[model samples]
Target: MRSDTCQHTAIIGAGIAGLACARALDAAGLPATLFDKARGAGGRMSSRRLPDAVLDLGAQFFSVRNATFRRAVEGWHKAGSIAPWPASLWSAQAGRWQRHEDDLERLCGTPSMSAVTRHLAKGLTVKAQTRIERLVGSAGQWQLVDEHGEHHGPFTRVVISAPSPQAHALVAPHDATLAEACEAVIQRPCWAAWALFDAPLPALPGVDDDWQAVRVNDPRLRFVVRNQLKPGRQDQGESLSLLANLEWSEVRLEDSPETIVEALLDAFQQALPDGSRLPEPSALGAHRWRYAQPDVFAGGEAVNLDYRLSASGLSLCGDGWRGPRVEDAWLSGHHLGEALAADAI
Candidate 1:
């Protein structure tokens, strides 16, 4: 139940950013309801469950850079919501594989990337499969109209945590400055393919069987993750999540999934060294993220403000406003929520 004294906030999108914002607001005793078009939360952090394997088709893994996010990650790790991933990492450079040596620690949600967002979403009111088409009513009393012609709210404020393009569409009518800011940001598309193999990947001479991920510097393939090797997923069969390069994905954005799956699989095979072979895929799937990540920040550079909060009770925050990393999305929304809560006080 919501506190009657607190102003109600309607948050659109249930990805990491939205959930992070909601968490902050909830901690401050603010009333906020999340709305997402997907069947459940997690947005890019969501996962797909196969018959015997789980694949992360969106963000494969994230690294914590900010101290605030590092603390949150620590809490999640203690709660068993996330764990370090890619026990081994490699990079395919000049047609040869080399160890990716880095001191940075990367984390992925336990079981799947969605677990983190799902954990954040607990106890928070969320309306799934509710795609808010436009904002209705006036400032100080905003209403959300969904695709089903359903009107929700009389919300005191509406915060759009969608990608910059989508957020622009929602706030254009209410606040020109917010819309312009959203418009200034640029995003890119991506193609992710999942392949479940009948057998584990063939081990290389120098690479260990535990080699979990590789950065393929091929023209077509950017990343290939051994999904089954991730923590909390050892029970599953061998599976791989193949992410295509941004340029390749953008060129073939409208291509069919079947075409993409085949292309990425071919690219993966080609990226392998001599005598290396892959097991036959038992199942294959592909997904296209129209706004996968922001390519350029607003005004061609990162700004001082982490988010945009208008006097009209309209606001915007997402990966575009910050950097493309997962930490940026969370911080953008977290700071926005903190600002809103402070205003109410």
Candidate 2:
């Protein structure tokens, strides 16, 4: 057990939101102790290394719409951690491909999707593979107890940026009102199947030179991206990542990796153009995201739920309240971090 409240905060969940929040707090000259249950810090912005290729198995790309997020992305871009994905995009409507001519600024982390979070994690004290089960203590300051029976904190403030379900579990015994609100937040599951092929899908009319990613209207799959075409990725060989739609993912959420990979692969092949052929994949694996996207069926605004800031020193922020996007996650964390910084100072 460690008892120290030296103007430091315990930020649970080292995901994008957590990392963003901690970055803001650090900017204000405050220290944060970040904790995550995963072996790495990225959370849903995950990247996986296959026997033949490295894939951005989680969030393939994000559009920078917010001024704050744009500035942050620019800094990362200048630092060579991120870059604009100029490759064309395609949308499937009425079973036909439609070239996306929006020319919007779509960006992705260099090397892999997790690179952005890894860059933001620099100079921050993050505790990986440590799950802080329940928060204990009172009067605005609480200590966190890990699953290993170890104790940490006595911090002046705590910010929880985990998925709403997990965040509710941690804050429930302490604040029922906040927990009830979190229960109302809807999140859906998703799965990404990363498949490496000896031969890529044959070029169709509007593919290759025109589009590297496509949104499928199929019931089984939602998105497919040619991983090798992205900047900082392998220039040769063929790799594809298939993201399952919300409804399909919900039904197959508990399915085996082999089952999901096979199903998504079959669906992708079927969705391809009539003359195209998908080579039998050489390497195949899948990642399951239990809390993929916020249903957002209840809110019209991006920042739907208000952040929680108790006088007792407990705070909350995440994409759950701020809608579902990388930008929303960043904003939720940043706003709460700014408020916490002001109070601590």
Candidate 3:
């Protein structure tokens, strides 16, 4: 039941977007506090560590397209928090493999996907494992209530960087405009499976052993990446991240993790070339992201606006407000933080 009566900005969610917003505010000489239900930051960028494998169950790699994000990426690269990955790519369709090149520079967090968010979260005040279930007060003075019924607030403003559906629930009772905006965005689900093999996978015909990733046009699996091949990762074993197709995952959303792990592993085997056999995995696991990516913008065409700000000191920012890329999430929060610093919200 601890409470704070200070004049601070309360940011709900310590993901990439939320961290970006907090950083922007900090640079502008404003104080903000971040809260997250997870044990650490990174949100979708989080990673899982096993006895011999470090698997990235979400956001395998991110590309830099915009100048702002590019600049940030450069800094991260210099700071050793991120590194380029997947220099070789392959595409698989009906068990046919071919070299795929897109000329896009993709980077992943060093050691694990969560490193980037951890770097962003450094020096910032964060309350981890705190699920803010309710916004209790009104207007200028707001209070946040967690799932344990613990109250923590009296903040000047609140910014929600969670997924669209979760954000909608919090804003519905306060601001209709923000609520409707959140409601208009739909998020898709994804089931990611990780497997650590005792040995390397067999190379496909005409494919080199250095091939690190694959884009599969299969009904069950969509993308697969070799964790050990990625830059800055220790070669504990042949680790693979199997990402299931969106529609396939959505239909089996409630399925148990064991079911998902088995299904995705079977899918990966089917995706291999005709005579190639997959080695027995030493360890396996699965993670379900109920709200993984933005599916559609029900409010007509997708808007280019990076964020949404309300006059009631409530603001919204995330990939749902912009696009699905990690860059979009960062931009959304960064722009909103700037606006708030200028007293625009």
* Candidates in order: C-alpha RMSD to true structure: 2.0, 3.1, 3.4
Model 1 whole-model lDDT (C-alpha atoms): 0.90
Score candidate 2 by lDDT.
0.82
For 1-345, candidate 2 gives per-residue lDDT tens digits of 223337889999998889988999999888999999999799888788666677887788988877877888888998888888846788774346877778578888888888899999999999999998998997556899999989997887888888888888998998777777778888899999988888756777665553689888889988998888888876547898899999999999999999999998888777777666787888888889999888852222443444667766777788887767887787788878888777765
Error at 8, model 3, angstroms: 1.2
Give me the candidate number with maximum TM-score.
1
Q: What lDDT tens digits, residue by residue, belong to model 1 across residues 1-345?
A: 433465999999999999999999999999899999999999999999877888999999999878999998998998899998877999986458888988898999989999999899999999999999999887779999999999998999899999999998898887899988988898999999988888778878677778899999889999999888898998998889999999999999999999999999999888787788888898898999999999986521255787888999998888888889889899989999999888887
Worst 10 residues of 1 by lDDT: 297-306
Write candidate 3's Cα lDDT for 27-86 as tens digits. 877789999999988899999988787889999999988888898889888889998887
Scored by CA lDDT, what does every candidate get? 0.90, 0.82, 0.87
Instruction: List the candidate 2 regions with Cα displacement exceeding 4 Å.
Output: 1-5, 93-95, 297-306
Candidate 3 has which clashing residue pairs, if any?
none
Candidate achieving higher TM-score, 2 or 3? 3
Q: Which ten residues in a row have the lowest lDDT in candidate 3?
A: 296-305
Q: How far is candidate 1 from the true structure (C-alpha RMSD, Å)?
A: 2.0
Candidate of highest lDDT: 1
